[model samples]
Target: MLAALIRQAQQAGLSPEPGFAPKELHWLAQLHSGKFTGVLPLREGKKGRQVARCPELSQPEMMALPRVLGQTQAAHFLADSCGVIALLPERAGQEVDAKTQAKHGAYAALLERAAQDLPQLLPVLEVLRNPAELAELRAELAQRGAKATDRLSFAVDGLDLLESELWYDWWRRFRRQVFGQPTTTGTMLDLSSGEVVTPAKTHPKLNKLGVGAMPTGASLIGYDKEAFSSYGLQAGENGAVSEENAAAYRAALEHLLAQAPVLGQMKVAVWFDHRQAEGQALIDAIENPATLTQASETFSWDDWDDTEAIQIVQTPEQQAAVAHTRAQQLLSALRRGETPPTLTAQYFALAISGASGRAMVRDWHTGSLEQLAEAVATWFEDLAITNLSGKRAKRPRFFSLLMNIQRPKPQSTSMDDYLKPIRNLQLPLWRAALDPNAPIPFSAVAKLMEAHKAQVMTGQFSEALSRDGDGEDKSRIYTRMALLKAYHNRKARRQLARGQGGFLMSSSVDPHHPSPAYHCGRLMYLLANVQDAQGSDVNAGVVQRYYGAASSTPALVLGRLTRLSQHHLAKIAREKPGLALTLERDIAAVWSALGHALPKTLSLEEQSLFALGYYQQLADSVSRRQDLAAQRKAAAAQADPHPATSPLAETTQTEQTAQGE
Candidate 1:
């Protein structure tokens, strides 16, 4: 893996040499003939600051920048205030300690030493050595409103000292010599390269290779204790990777980290075979398959330009059309046994997280694109539970699915704290998406079950239209059902692979399912529907009153609810005999499927099945009710071709009839 990353870095045109790294200089110290001229700010007139020319670095230029790790008192040839100013600024409140004085001396000395081989650095070193020139540079910075602490690099006669190849070559050679020399203290070795160093006891820290997105001070490889170092290796000695390969590996990893997609606290980097254009398409397919389905028809590669100033706004109808198109494509593949085009490119993904200044490897996955495609297809196929309209619910992104199961937060909880628990599971779920054989986390299933219970018991159905005309969001419920269905389907798939009898759950409710728990769930939905049939809204409906108990201990709660359902059915019989009779027949069917008695208690998985049955049955019921209302409207239209009735009144009457009004 390390070798592959190093190769990727080299291919990406990153600096393959150990000493070269890019540094963002905020303020350029202008010079003329080795004399301090003025201070030029990089980000002037942009994002609340003023400057000229921006001074952006080209890829090659950035790679060629001289790099070094001067942690504290050790100063770089190009450095901040303490290294450039002999006397600290008063407003800056920086003390000119003995160590700070040493840094300024060291900075000038290094440049002077390198000036011999690189004459371009000579002018910059002359200005730094001159106390008068240094004071003038500081005063000029103050005049320009540049922060005293801003990073400073010299530009002599229109040439950036950092960009000078002579300087870069000289620094490279000096760094190699420094690392190769012996130290009085026990050696610190580079974990990736096994190169020895002094002062610091372990490898250079990670997270600095990229922007601040990577965790600060996180050690990807380190050994601080005696127990961790083995085979007579000294503490912090990395013996596995030698100096020859470490530099290349670190460079490659830094390139990957810079563009790696982040999810909550985890960073996932993907690398694909050279044949592939990029790994982003594969990642999008895994993380959000809906985007990949019918993508070519709905969008063009040219449509997304990072440099484009104006974003094209999509209408809701367009969004719906895209979703519908994806649904049709996925459904067609499943029904007609059509295969997706073969993907030959292979890819690798590494998931890492940081905590307490340590880097943790969450997961690593490597597979052909075909495996990923199939895994995603199977994921959606098994998870495609019906919506309120009884059509396949739109597939959700992996992140959205996880968000659905996120624990409910109190108003006092911060957004980050609320999301922490869910964030911790992102890597595992991502791995599961890329590997069909992997199991969905049981904790996720349990959380979904809890969310379902809360939705039902609180009478706050997601995207549900209740009898009282109260609107509630049902997206959460849909997400829960989708996950539940996939959970059972994957479990069954594994069982079948082992030659054990296991049944896959359907997207819609299956009346003849073998599990009694499924029928109980259906019964629960039917009983609730029976109560809903009553013209008047009840403050406490069957679901709100007993869903928790009915789902878990059906034998105890469902029997009582079943008996009470008769009273609910009887009260609505006079007003809407049709709806009442339909409810009666549905209840009987579920009871027959459930057998003579319900299960005494349901296990966690069985309880999930019960929730699935309830959700699917509710979807079936709502869909039928809507169809019945539509049929009534059509028939009434035929009866009165030009009746003097408002459409609103007609629709309201139709809705009332459907609800047994």
Candidate 2:
């Protein structure tokens, strides 16, 4: 990983030479050598040292400027102290603080020394020397391309020396003549590049990782403890790399982190140095896969331009069409025992967080883009279920699955402290997504089970759609169902690996042939449906009231539920023949599969299957409704070649309904 990162840094032009591995320094050189016009001049506030403004320059030349003079610490001077004068006019207290007085004194001494050597900087020094003339000079500076927030630096000719030349010359001379070489404590093997070089005492820090990790940025690589050192080597020397290499890696990491997608504490980034284009395409493909073979216009590369802003028309039908296309393509490749070249690019992902002041690398996943796409395809297939609103989604993303555990706050990493226990499982879940063989973390599974059990016991039907009139956020039971199914499928694969019996993960309920636990689950849903259909205004149906008991101890719950269901069926048969016949046939088919009796009790795994069975049965209702609608449409078209539409047609509805609905 270190070598790969080093290579990436080299590709990024961060490390210019074997010995010289400067971070922003090399970046600065690139900006200067390139065609930049000017820099934004940020001025300090009148009250404190905060940047008050970085007003624009009128000159077209300045607009092209790239950022060269970036944030720097370590004995640096700014305009408030070094150039012109401090905004003492605005401060109520006239007494100069000791720190400010000392800083200005140093600046004055540096100017005097520079005046003695570099004669061209005389005018700039003259301006810095007078406090009485500072106000007029600052006004002039603003119009001349300096912002109120600018650190007053100089240029000789292009507005005189361009400020770049003045600062660059001074800094270069300072480095060579005064700053000299960085102090090196010991020579050690460079782990990053595999060479002997002087190691840095401490690595650079990782900044801007939301709040509460640490006030100061976290150190990416550190060794403060004696136990961390080897052979009596202190601090960073234990995993020594030259200061140059260290700087390079830190810079690269910082760059990647800046663009990474963050969710709560987790920050995620992906890379594919060798075939970046292909890898990005694969990522997009997995999100919206192509289910069809390539035709002349089977795939459109134009659809994947993230750099360009474009409006998308994403209707449900359009999304479903794309998902179908992607799935078909994936299935063909899997059947053929080959990975598509377009999807075979190498890929790597990193997930990071901050813990106190240290960086916590949550996950690092590496695989072929093909493997990733294939895994994603499987993930989608496993998660196939009707959402709470009775609408089908192609597949839920990793973040969507996470929301089932706990939702992230908008625009920030401020997850509720109460959710910390479950939030910690997010990393393992993300890893499980990338690798099919990897088991979903047991902790995460337990959390889901616990939450489900609680919901079941409370008899609160959570997944009321937005249109349900209650105006509550829909429940995540569908996603919970998907996750449990995926988990058990992986567990089953593990069984297969150990030369034991295993079950295939199903996309829909198979009443004809399902596990005994699945049958128990189906029975529960059936009982609930009968009670709902026969009764009026039942606040919570049988499944909602007793799902916990039925799932855990099926034999004990089923007999009572079965007796109540018989009463429901009898009433339905007396009142509604069409629905009654459908319910009766459905009951017989499922009961036939269950044989004579229900299982006595369910363990964790069986209970999970029970949830799947219930979810699948629920999802099947949507399919059955769609099929009924299609059949009606066919009959109407047959009766009249083109049926006339009217308000009457809108008012009318299907008389026959599915038992579950």
Candidate 3:
């Protein structure tokens, strides 16, 4: 991994050379002929900042300045604060302590010492030694509203001292004497020249502890405690990796993180071995496969450059189909014995979280891009389930799938607390999406089930089945059913691996399914429908009253509901015999499918099947109702082709004749 990272950084033309790193300097200290002129802000609001190849020393470099509690070593170059430059007391109005005074002297002394070798540093040293000039520096900063803590670097005669090679070499030698020798060793792929090289022997010890652009104290390879030390290794001696390799790896990771997709507190860095892969495209393909399929038909290579032709394709989606279609085409080329641009490249992903101060690597994934695409395609296929319209429902985005498990927020709960479960499930769920054979986490299914049951308890069934303007059935409910189906499909896959057959849930209701719990769920929905058909407003109907009991202890509640359903059926028979008979037949079909006796109590898995069966039955019934209504309308239209001269018009004429008589 470290070798790969070093290669990546070198290939990107980023110099990961030891003893030097990129730092953003906030202010530029203008100087002329050994005299302080003024300070200028490197960046204003919404403006770019100046970056310098500053000298970095130590594992975790000291902030503000390079000084310890009692030690008075000045920051060699690039002090981050006025306090370091002027030796300001720790607090305002406080007297300068002896240690601070020593640091002040050391700051000038280091420059004086460096000036001997690099004559260009002599002017900067002269300004640092003058008290009046230091006071003028403070006054200039105060006028510009610059805080004492802002980072600033010096410039003399249009020459940035930090960017000077002479200063860099001087600082490198000083760092070597203070810190120990560089221990980096081993052959690594030199991405720059595309050859293997020993960077340890060629580069200096210049690695710093941090993840991205910001330098952090937290370490991924720190041995701060005695217990962490072993094999004759002492504390602070990170024997696992040399500083040079670590720096290269850090630079590579930082590059990846700069463009990685983020989920909650985690940032996922995805890349191809040869080139950078569009991570969002992979995520979108998994989240909404149908959209990619639709986009492919209209996506043209020519339209890419025609702004007017592709004007509708803008931010976020931003011609998303291009990536998806191109990826598929590349994969197709490989299968057809043609050389594809991205043929046979491996996909790499690393998910990391730095919320705990220490950097934590949550997951590392690697696979052929072909396998990744197949896995994502398989994920959507397994999750296929019908909507309330009895059509295949849209797959929710990956984030939406996780969000479905979150409990309804209470007024007192913080957003962070409410989203904790979703955050916890991100890594496992992401892994599942990437691995076709991996099962959806059982804990995730359980949480979703709990949420589903809670919605039932609160009489949310009607809302779940409600139609939206886009003709989509209730999205949250559809997501729930899809997740349930996926859970069962994965379980079946594992069971097949074990040489056993298991029930697999389909996209729509299957009346021939053998599970009594499923049929019971179907019966539950049918009974609820019968009660609703009575045309009476009941505060709490069958689903709200009996769902929990029926889903858990089917034997106890289903039989009672079946008996009560007869009364509702009888009322419907008196008013609409055809509808009553249809309901009766539907109930009989569900009972016929239940070949086994109803279990006394359901296991968690069985309960999920029950919910799936219930939702699918409802969706099928809705489709039937829609089809029946459309059929009736068509029949009426056929029966009276000449609607303007029909029975109603004749009846009105007869009534007028009677009035005349």
Best by lDDT: 3
Measured on C-alpha atoms, candidate 1 has an lDDT of: 0.65
lDDT of 1 by residue, 1-661 (tens): 6656666666666664544444446677788877777877775453222221122221222223333323233455554452344344546555556766766765666666677787777787777777788778767776666654556777889987655554555565665565443354435554444455442334344543332233334656667676765666663343444433444565566567666766656777777664233235546555665555453333322332222222223875554455444443433453445554554566777787666656677788888755655666677777788876768877777767777885456799976777777765676677777777787888888877777778778777622544433222556667778888888888888999999978888888788788998889888877766766543222246678888898889999988887887887888787788778787888888878877778999998899989888878877887877787898889899999996889999998877877762
Error of 3 at 83 (Å): 7.1
- What TM-score would each prediction reach against the true structure? 0.78, 0.73, 0.74
Give the Cα-based TM-score of candidate 1 against the true structure: 0.78
Candidate 1 differs from the real structure by a C-alpha RMSD in angstroms, to one decimal, of 7.6
Per-residue alpha-carbon lDDT of model 2 for 241-292, expressed as tens digits?
7766766676567656665666545876667665454344444443333323
Question: Ten-residue segment with the worst summed lDDT in candidate 2?
Answer: 22-31
In the order shown, what is each candidate's alpha-carbon RMSD? 7.6, 9.1, 8.1
Poorly placed runs, candidate 2 (over 4 Å): 15-173, 176-179, 182-186, 208-215, 226-232, 281-338, 341-345, 387-391, 406-416, 456-475, 512-514, 534-539, 633-661
Collision count for each candidate, in order: 12, 22, 1
Give me the displacement of residue 287 in model 3, in angstroms: 7.6
Model 3, position 163: C-alpha lDDT score: 66
Candidate 3 TM-score versus the reference: 0.74
Cα lDDT, model 3, residue 596: 38
Writing each residue's lDDT as its tens digit, candidate 3 over 325-359 gives 55554333333454322335567777776634466
Give the number of colliding residue pairs in candidate 1. Answer: 12
